[model samples]
Target: MSGQRSDTECRGTHEWVSAAPFRSHLADLVGTTGLPWRAVALYADVPTRCVRSLLFGRRGRVVRRIPARVAERLLRVRAAQLNGLTARSGDAWAAHDLASRLAGRGQSAAEIALLARATRDEAALWLVGPPGWVSARSVLLLQAACHAAGMDWAGPADPWEPSPAEAAA
Candidate 1:
C-alpha cells in the first residue's frame, strides 16, 4: 500500500472482480429501477472520471471500492428487475443485503449496522447527487466496515491469510 500513486488510482490492486462486468450489471440495474444515473453513481461511490469512462468512452483508472452492502443491493435489484418483482421502487429495500454479505464475509450485524448508518449519513452529507457522491460513500463505507469488522487493527495475515485449500494449492 506504499507507493507513488495518483489520487485517481484505485485503492486495491488485486482484481477480485472485473470492472466491465460489474459496470454493465449496474447499468442494467439503474435502467430497471429507474434510479437516476447520478443517484446510482452516487450510491456506488464511483468517481466522476471513472463514471464518465464507464458510461462514455473516456479512459481512466478503475475505481472499485463498492460496499458489500451496495453490491448486494444492486444484485437484489437486478434480480428483482429480471424476475419482475415489485415493479420498481428503490426504497423497497433498506440495504440489508450489504449487511448480510458482510456477515457472510465474517462481519457482524452490529458492525454492518454501524457501517450502514455512517454510510447513509455520509451519503446524505454529500447531497446524494454530487459528482463525488460515489467516491465519498465508498470511502466511508469501506472505512467504517473495516473498522467495525476489526480488520483495521488485525494483523495482515489475519485479514488476508490464505485458506487451507489455497495454501495447499
Candidate 2:
C-alpha cells in the first residue's frame, strides 16, 4: 500500500455521480490512445453504449450523471492503459495473431464472441489491434471461432499448450 487508493477499492456500491468528469476522462483516453469508444470502454470495464451516449449525446439529450461504478471505473482508466487488456502470463503471441486473422476476415467482435462462446469483453479486449500478452484461453476461443466459421485457419506451430482453465476467452 503506497498510501494511494487502489483502483479496485469501491466507495459506494450504489450511487449516482456527475458524468462530466467521467466523460472528460474518457474523451482524454480516446484522444490519447486513438481508439474507438468500444475498445476504450472495454479497457475500463464500462458499458460501451453508455460511454458512447455520454460522449456523443443520446437523442439530443445530455447525460448529467452516471452510475458510481461507471464513473469510478472510467476515472481509473489511464491513457497508456487504454492500449488493450493482456493476460498476465499465457499464450503471449498466439491469440494475438489468431484474433488479427479473424478480424482481417471481417468477423465482427460480436460474431467472434458468439462463435467462441465467450463474452463480448473478451472479444473486444483480444481482437483490438496490436494486442500482446493474451489469455491462454484466447487461443482456444479464437481457434474455436475460426473452426466454427470454417475460416481454414491454423494454430501456432509449436504444438498446443493446453490451458488449465476452461475456455471462455
Candidate 3:
C-alpha cells in the first residue's frame, strides 16, 4: 500500500506537515527577500544548521527533521519580510503567539501538553512565563498542533525583548 492514506481513514488524526514541502516553501520565500541564509538565521534566531538541513536535506546522509519551532520562526520571518516589518530581538513573541493561537482555538494547557508531548506544567510554563528556555522538541509538537488547527504561526511584529524602560523598571 502507498504511504498515503485517504482522508476518511485519517479524519481525526494529526500528522506533522512534511519538512520537504516546508523547506521548499521556505527557500522560495527567503529567496525573494535577497537575504543570505546566515543573515536570515541571525535575524530569526534560528540555527544555521537548521536552515542548511532544510535547504539541502542531507543529500546522501541521514535526513534531519527540521524542528517545528524553526519552521514556525521561518514562517514569521517570511511574514515580516512580506509585511515590511523589521526583525526583532528574541523569540518570546513567537511563544506568546503560539499560546494565543492555542487559546483562540479553545485548547487548554492539558490539550497543548498532549499535542506538544509535554507535561501540563511545562505547557503552562511556556505559555505563562517570559518565554524562557522551551525545548526544541516541544516546539515541534506545538507547531504541529498549530498546523492541524489551520492557525497562522506568523505573529504580529511586536518587539520580543523588553524595552529599555521596562528593563530598567
Candidate 4:
C-alpha cells in the first residue's frame, strides 16, 4: 500500500540546472566583448529582453522542452574549409560560433538572439518576436547553451559596430 498505489504510483521529480550560471555567463560575454548586438541577435534568434536578462542577470521564464537535435545540427560545422575565407565572412562563422555556444548551454530561440553578435532588432527578427524584446526564460536557456558548448568567446569591440570591411559584405 505504501510502495504502490491502487491506480498509479508516484514518480521521482527532477530539477534542472538553475538560471543563474547561464545568466552570469552571458553577462560576462556581453560585458567583455564588442560583438555586434545585431549579430548576436540574429545568431541566437532571440529578442532584446531575453538578451538583456542574460546581460543583466535577471531571471526569466524558460520553455521546458528543447529541440536538442535541431540545436545540435545548427551548432555543428558543415564544410571542411574554405580557400580564402576571412575571419568576418558574412558573419556566418560568428553566427555558427554563437549557435555552438548557445547549443552547448541549452538556450532557446529567444535566448539565442539575445546573446548573439547582432542587434536587438535583428535578434527579434530571428526570434520572430517584436522589436526590442526579450524574456527571462530565453536568457536562462541561452546561458545554458553557452555553458554546454564551452564557448569561451570574447568580442573585439564594445556595442559591436561592424568593421568597414564586414559592413561591405
Candidate 5:
C-alpha cells in the first residue's frame, strides 16, 4: 500500500499530460522556496506522495505521465505562494499548546481545527502528542485567533519558561 496510488490519483477522468513540464515546475518550486515536496503538497492540498512521485518517481520507476489535475495544480504553484509555510511544521509545539489552552476554555478539537484551518484529526494529534509536523498555516490561524482573544504565543508558555529562582538554584 505504500507504493500504491489512490483511486483519485489513478482514476483521474481528465486527460493525462506529459509529466515533463509539471516536473520542471515542481523542481523549480522546491528549489526556489527550499521547501520539500510535502510542504508544496500541503499548500496545494494534494497528497505528499503525489508531488514526490512526480518529482522523484516511485520504487525506481519514473512517472512519465501525470494526471491533468495534478499537472495543472503543480503548474500554477509559485514560490511566492509558499511564504510562511514550511515542510517540517516548525510551530507544532505552539499549536499543541494553543489547542490545549483552547480546549480548556471549552473549545473542542473540531472547533480548534476550524480556527486553524486544519482537520480535527490534526488538532487531536497535536493535543495528544508532544509535537510533530504541523503546518504553518495552522499556527498562523491559531495565532490570529489567540491575538483576537487577547492571548500571546511569543514563545513557550510560562510553565515551560525557566523561573529566576530556578535559574538561581
Candidate 6:
C-alpha cells in the first residue's frame, strides 16, 4: 500500500485544509454564489475599484498578487456561507452528494477534471470534499456535469443549519 493515507480514511480528523483560490476564481465566485460585487467588496472590506479590476480585468489588467488581507476576507466570506459545527462543514456535505451521484453513474475524478476544467488534484479534492472553498466556476461546471449525466445534484436546498455543537453552545 502507498504510504500516504487517503482522504477518506482521514475524514473529520485533518487540519488546515487549504481553501486558497486564484484571484480570477474570486471573480467567478461572485457570479456562482449570486453575491453582488458591491456586497463582496463591502464584506471583504476591499475597495470596489480593486474588486472591479480583479474581476472584470478592466482599468488595464488583472492584479497578479491579491493583497493578503483581501484574500483572507474573501475566503472568510465564502467559508462563512458553508460554516457548520466545524470549520470545514458546509460544502463538504454537498460535495459528498456530488461524489455519490457521479459514482452511481460510473464516473471518475478524471471525468470531473474534464467536466470542471480543473486539474486532476483539484477534481480529486472535489470528490473527496473539504476543499478550501468551492469556486463559482466549479459550481457551474459541476452543475453542468450533473445535467449532462442526467443526474440531479443531490444537495439540500436550505441554508446551512447549525451543527450540534453550535446548537448546544
Could you tally the backbone clashes for each prediction? 3, 0, 0, 33, 0, 1
Model 6 spans with C-alpha error above 4 angstroms: 1-92, 153-169
lDDT of 3 by residue, 56-130 (tens): 666555344444555667767664453242222234455556765797789898888777566888778767764
Q: Across residues 1-169, which tens digit of lDDT does each residue of candidate 5 receive?
A: 1333553445424467899888888888878876555556655645555677888887898989866766766777788767656443657777888788787778888998888777889888878864658877676566556544555445222221234886698
Off by over 4 Å in 5: 1-12, 84-94, 97-169
18-130: candidate 1 lDDT, tens digit per residue: 34665777778567655444445444433323334455543454544433323343444343533242233332122333344465577554554445444444334333233
In model 2, what lDDT does residue 53 have? 76
Best by lDDT: 5
Which pairs clash in the backbone of model 5?
A: none
| C-alpha positional error of residue 92 in candidate 4 after TM-score superposition, expressed in Å | 12
Report the Cα lDDT for residue 81, model 5: 67
Ranking by lDDT: 5, 2, 3, 6, 1, 4
Model 6 TM-score relative to the real fold: 0.35
lDDT of 4 by residue, 1-169 (tens): 1121211121233223344544444444444443333234323543333344444434454422222321222233122211112232333333444554554556665556655434444554534423343333333334334533545544212212234786698
TM-score of each: 0.31, 0.48, 0.37, 0.26, 0.48, 0.35
lDDT of 2 by residue, 1-169 (tens): 1222322342444477888988888888888866566556544655445677789977798888776757777788786554433333446465656676787889777776665445777667766643544554345556545544455544221101123452344
Better of 5 and 6 by TM-score: 5
- Candidate 4: residue 154 lDDT (0-100): 45
Candidate 4 accuracy as lDDT: 0.38
lDDT by candidate, in order shown: 0.41, 0.59, 0.56, 0.38, 0.67, 0.51
What 10-residue stretch in candidate 2 is worst by lDDT? 154-163
lDDT of 6: 0.51
Candidate 6, pairs of clashing residues: 19-132
Report lDDT (Cα) of residue 163, candidate 3: 41
